[model samples]
Target: MLLRMPGVYRPQGDTRLLCAAFHDANLPPGGTVLDIGTGTGAVALTAARAGAASVTAVDIARRAVVTARANAWLSGLNVEVRQGDALTIAAGRRFDIVLANPPYVPSVVDVDARGPARAWEGGCDGRAVLDRLCAAARDLLTPGGTLLMVHSALCGTEESLIALRGLGLKAAVVSRAREPFGPVMRGRADALVRAGLLEPGDIDEELVVIRADRAITDH
Candidate 1:
């Protein structure tokens, strides 16, 4: 079993969905892979298994970093784990592939709070971290590199596509799935109604996997 310390966001549907997306990406030989908001280094491990030359994972929570490191060791995978905001840690680095399953649940409270909540809360609009990544991702991608990210459609899948395209990447919804609302989404169902993101009785949210590629000509 993968090692998990308390407070780390456990791997779930979004993680599995992104894992499937990774199967479709064209990873370069001996390529470098970066997993943002990695919890227990699940995606990083998958990347290593897929033959990525090197894998690095970053998470904002200290517990998550520790848990991910432990899991990597237990799995006998060479994954570098670090603790920092996804955007900050990714700055000044370029990767052949970047993967993320960021915090997208619209929170009743602003997402600035630390603790277990930090793992999922993304403010009223739920794009707090995702938006930042769209803006900052180009700096972290080599020309022709790809970004594979997953999030709830409740967070505006179209918005993310538009943002990434605006940054000059070729972006599109590569895959989608409807999943039963998990604890966080279920608990915030009322607030989501108030936020106009859900209907009164909506019991599920669609998740989407988006792929964006930096053109080889971007250089």
Candidate 2:
């Protein structure tokens, strides 16, 4: 069956990449999967199609949840999309596979509260959202379960790796792509320049896709 996801979904490109990467990792069939920041339910639906028995998708935006559910129904995929922050979801809820394409757009400028919550906004240095997600992922994963995340290279990839390792999660770079800076970063730079956080000349930036996995250990 063809998969249908929202084109406007933030980090849509990375979301698609991570979904394909997880499938390629040979995750056990019929395992429960969690897709954090599941905009459009792409990764969650992909996991379901790849033989996950249950897929739970969570997002901070209610509209994202609604859109994800609609996409799931349209694609005939069974996925549970919930409206809640990833950090505050049900405690003790564990999954065999946890996947995320978080916001990695670092900015010195303040974000607009009314703006669409792009899944990839990393604060200041671009690791804000990623830090929260990685920390929470430690508790959300089951023994022997795996966590897959896609992030940008400019967002201090080394720091992110160290953070995950500090959390006792084994990390690796599974895939990467070099792309021009996204609008978030560009806009952030503009805002920062106006606010004196950055110079007008410091606008060009590069993006990379870094995938990390958390290895589950047996007690």
The TM-scores, one per candidate, come to 0.96, 0.82
Candidate 1, run of 10 with poorest lDDT:
105-114
Q: Rate the local accuracy (lDDT) of all candidates.
A: 0.89, 0.71
The numbered model that scores best in TM-score is: 1
Cα lDDT for residue 170, model 1? 94
Superposition TM-score, candidate 1 onto the true structure: 0.96
Model 2: lowest-lDDT 10 consecutive positions: 1-10
Residue-wise C-alpha lDDT for candidate 1, range 1-219, written one tens digit per residue? 688888889888889999999988978899999999898899999999899999989998899999989888888889999998877877888999999988888876444557988888887788989899889878889999999999999889889999999999999999888999888788778878888899999999899999999999898
Off by over 4 Å in 2: 1-11, 189-216
Model 1 regions more than 4 Å off: 109-112
Error of 2 at 105 (Å): 0.9
Task: Give the Å error, residue 176, model 2.
Answer: 0.5
